[model samples]
Target: MSERVIAPKSRGFLFLDSHPTGCRRLVDEMWQAVPEPVPAGGEGPVALIIGSSAGYGLAATIAGLARVGIRGIGVCFEKAPARRTGTAGWYRTAATARLARQHGRDMVFLNGDAFSDTMKEQVAGLLAERFGGRLDFLIYSVAAPRRTDPDTGHVHASVLKPIGSPCTTKTLVFDDDGAPEVKEVTTPPAEGDDVEQTVAVMGGTDWERWITYLDDRSLLAEGFATVALSYIGSPLTAGIYRQGTIGAAKSHLEATARALDERLGKALGGRALTSVNAAAVTQSSTAIPGIARYVGLLRGVLGDAMVSPTGQLVELWDQLTGDGPLVLDEEGRIRLDTWELDPAVQDAVAERWSVATSDTVPELADLDWFGDEVRRLYGFSVPGVDYSAAVDTEVAWPTRIN
Candidate 1:
């Protein structure tokens, strides 16, 4: 394959092509941010990270390898480079595998649909053969538009709409000049089985199934634990996010975590819980209606206090593997969004939300920083990356299972 300089091809927040070298640089920075590993008695923890290509999943994988010294297996679905550039997650995963090798850690990337029985079976066999047949931890961080039921073969698609009534909220849209412009977006309520389908796709059914499948094959370790990433925005975004169809799905996920906690407790002295993470610029979050505006305002208010997804997951590893007891909320979840939900932070964001306009929002929120972060997600505006230099896009995952 010949090398060529690849610029970002995006419409709104949807990016089509990714730069491999820039993605590798971002992965390297994330690895560098990881603190020194805590002492693991043996070969560290063996973990299975589903949806481990981008966002919190990718962060968790890096933290586990560099901070917790884990031997990990990652499962994600991504398109490889062909006529066009490959997806950002593809390059990120390959870079992470390379990082694992550099540190002499065992890491495997499986390129396939993680919500399928075949992939689950393949991971189980890999665990038995290559990972010593014991899984210490399972991290679930999948965010997809649709999911096909492994048992019934029904396709469920998730929708980002309100549940009861239409929601009209103030949001931000990038204009022709690449500056954020204030706009009002109205999303209609869920119709027919929209809520149910959203729940089916984004719910904890697949998470539960993965655990059951692995447990049936005796793959869980003595002190096994599992965590699924979730979010509960403040009342500002409640109408469209927390009170919407996705909220219904998140409710199911939390309930599943409780039930799994009970089951794991009785079976192998294990645990299951959800980690409510903070908002950040992610490919999935960009699709939500008011998330962009909220995140911008959040960054403006929180400023240096805002924690990136990688930082949050690094702290999570400390809490999970530390000597002290786990600090949980009233609902048995690890609250990683405390900073974002602080009263002072929310008050400031609300004040800006009330009076923000296309002309005034530039002064109220750090839209320029937000734009740079979004571009970095696609490996376009990362620091120290030469966009003019021709680079090969055909990067391969060194330990891909499929």
Candidate 2:
């Protein structure tokens, strides 16, 4: 691997994010993707958006509100208040909420957990009081694996351990060498509390729970539409996600889509939609062991990866907002992950892996210009900043529901 200068982690270029203009560029791309106008600018119904702080939740809130004109309410589950600097989602939500409020949009922020009964009760009450129990959308966009199981009251931790025996494959970082390095990853088997526990935490249980409660309380609107995100990445994620406990849990989630479609579709006038969303580099995915380095090395191997230049993980975020060409709907459910798993793409990536090794330096061929984009997401690797810039450090949440 060639040594690129280590970039400091802090605000570098954009006012809020290093690449402010670059961020807008990505947003514009999303704006272009919704061929059918995703209407916005309204004050009619309510939109309960879980995980609206960052990731898909944030994109959904923006897209659904900006283009679709779902000018309803936004319910965010953020525990950033408990943390000093607050969560990344905190600032993103604040910036968007501020912009929305200035434009006469109805928006609300909450610093609470979405998996708790108390949180549910409070949000439900808010919706009832504000929108008269008329919520048109319920977006279950959360992606956390750590939650307290309501049934057992046990704090469950999701596992990424593979189901069967460990598997090994060649890893790619360089292609100059004629041969590749034989790298094997051993995924431990999840037994006892691992499998069941992981399922309880990441499966459709919480999603089902939320719908049942909302319906029982007569909170859902007549044409209510609900969507939950799911993904099955290519073999690149096999060592970490596939053949692991998390994979098992994901399977559980994938299965729930059908059942939820059946139940929610009937209840919501056949508008329950499940999208196996696109796969790209994500914050959560980046942090997983081996994935970060793999992605980094991939940037060198895949020449097409582009940098945001404005401190945003542009490509990944675009996919999350359903603003890309890869999304294809079968009936109503969208196959967003299909592109990531395309045989040709996977074959090309794997073939590169077979020919790359530590002894040889990899060339940028398939990677896009997404390096700066990925780095900007964490407020790093951006250009045109003092690096010693300062701030008041006294920003407050636009709305605190706790």
Candidate 3:
């Protein structure tokens, strides 16, 4: 008799025992739309991707191997396979490693907190030994609710509140019956050290630390490039996202890019930049107030115009490594949100937002698709997967875990 894997239960926001087949399918779709590029190096360009398990980080890692042919290392925090619960990231990372190998690429998915200096040092040391003390690229795409500072031993938690005043918005949440419920939310303005704490948790401090440590130790190759992801949305949710405590953090991130752009050039002829990404369905985004309903409506409005994470990544890869000049906005950062913010798209979204209600939402927004996207992020609701089949919750990860 053979042991079989069973579906794990969800503990609130956390889910366990992800479907391997679903994860593989999602990865396949991401690469299917991407055009493979010319191989860069024999072992591919040595690279590191922070927060490289799901969402943009996962898509970027897939694009790096399939499109850019980069042998990359990923840093993320995920629970290991357990008796009754194994994290979705564990399954995704396992599948990613297998896919990378099938493409004859080298990828190491490290399980640890990217906010920690210890993990950074471990990654730097590994890069030093494995790639002859040089890394060609680095990507920062971490999204965490809280962070514990290594130097000060202070824990900072991020808030999603607006900065100046209280505001009311409609947010979407799934009921116990798995049906969508539209809820009215009144959020107060951020006060006191909320902005500082949010920035401490979500800002560019850790990013700068990693770069300085690696560059100081001569781990970065000359002309190396680094990018961190940011989001600036439409006017509807601007108060909570673009102008909120998180926005303060993003501002710090952009400032870090400016400083590092000059510092990197001076240190090793390298470059540092932030890429403003388009909004999409992800584990992190769903929790944001009012973002779910907005994204659901946006999907309906944009339809074919909407860019998937992989699509954005393909464009990013081409722009960052292509033959033409580095295309950047006046702010010296790449703009990947142009399509999402198109007049036609935003006009439709704004129109829907004005008239949206629980009853009318079903007709206006593609909530079905929005729900599926969220499920798929956790390796559920994928096609061709037999939900009844037993799954191995004890599947081993082929990478180091700290």
Best prediction by TM-score: 1
lDDT of 3 by residue, 1-402 (tens): 224655535553345556766776777777666775545336778889998988899888888888888886988888875554456777778888877776777777789889888898889888976667889999999899999999988999999899989868998877667666788999999999999999998899999999988988888998899999889888899888989999999999999999999998997888899999998998898778999999999988877678898888777777777633667899998999998898888998999999888788888889888877877887787887776886555667875432
lDDT by residue (127-219, candidate 1, tens digit) is 999999999999999999999998789999999999889999988998766866888989999999999999999999999999999999999
Minimum summed lDDT over a 10-residue window in model 3 is located at 1-10
Q: Residue 116 in model 3: shift from native, Å?
A: 1.6
Candidate 1 vs candidate 3, TM-score winner: 1
Judged by lDDT, which candidate is best?
Answer: 1
Question: What local lDDT does model 3 show for residue 351?
Answer: 97
Runs of candidate 1 with Cα error greater than 4 angstroms are: 38-42, 400-402
Q: Candidate 1: lDDT over CA atoms?
A: 0.90
Which candidate would rank higher by lDDT, 1 or 2? Answer: 1
Candidate 2 C-alpha lDDT tens digits along 73-99: 555654343313334455566666665
> lDDT scores for all predictions?
0.90, 0.56, 0.83
Better of 1 and 3 by lDDT: 1
Per-residue lDDT of 52 in model 1: 91
Pairs with backbone N, CA or C atoms under 3 Å apart (clashes), candidate 1: none
**Per-residue lDDT of 370 in model 1:** 92
Question: Estimated TM-score per prediction?
Answer: 0.97, 0.76, 0.94
**Model 3 residue 5 distance off true place after TM-score fit, in angstroms:** 6.8
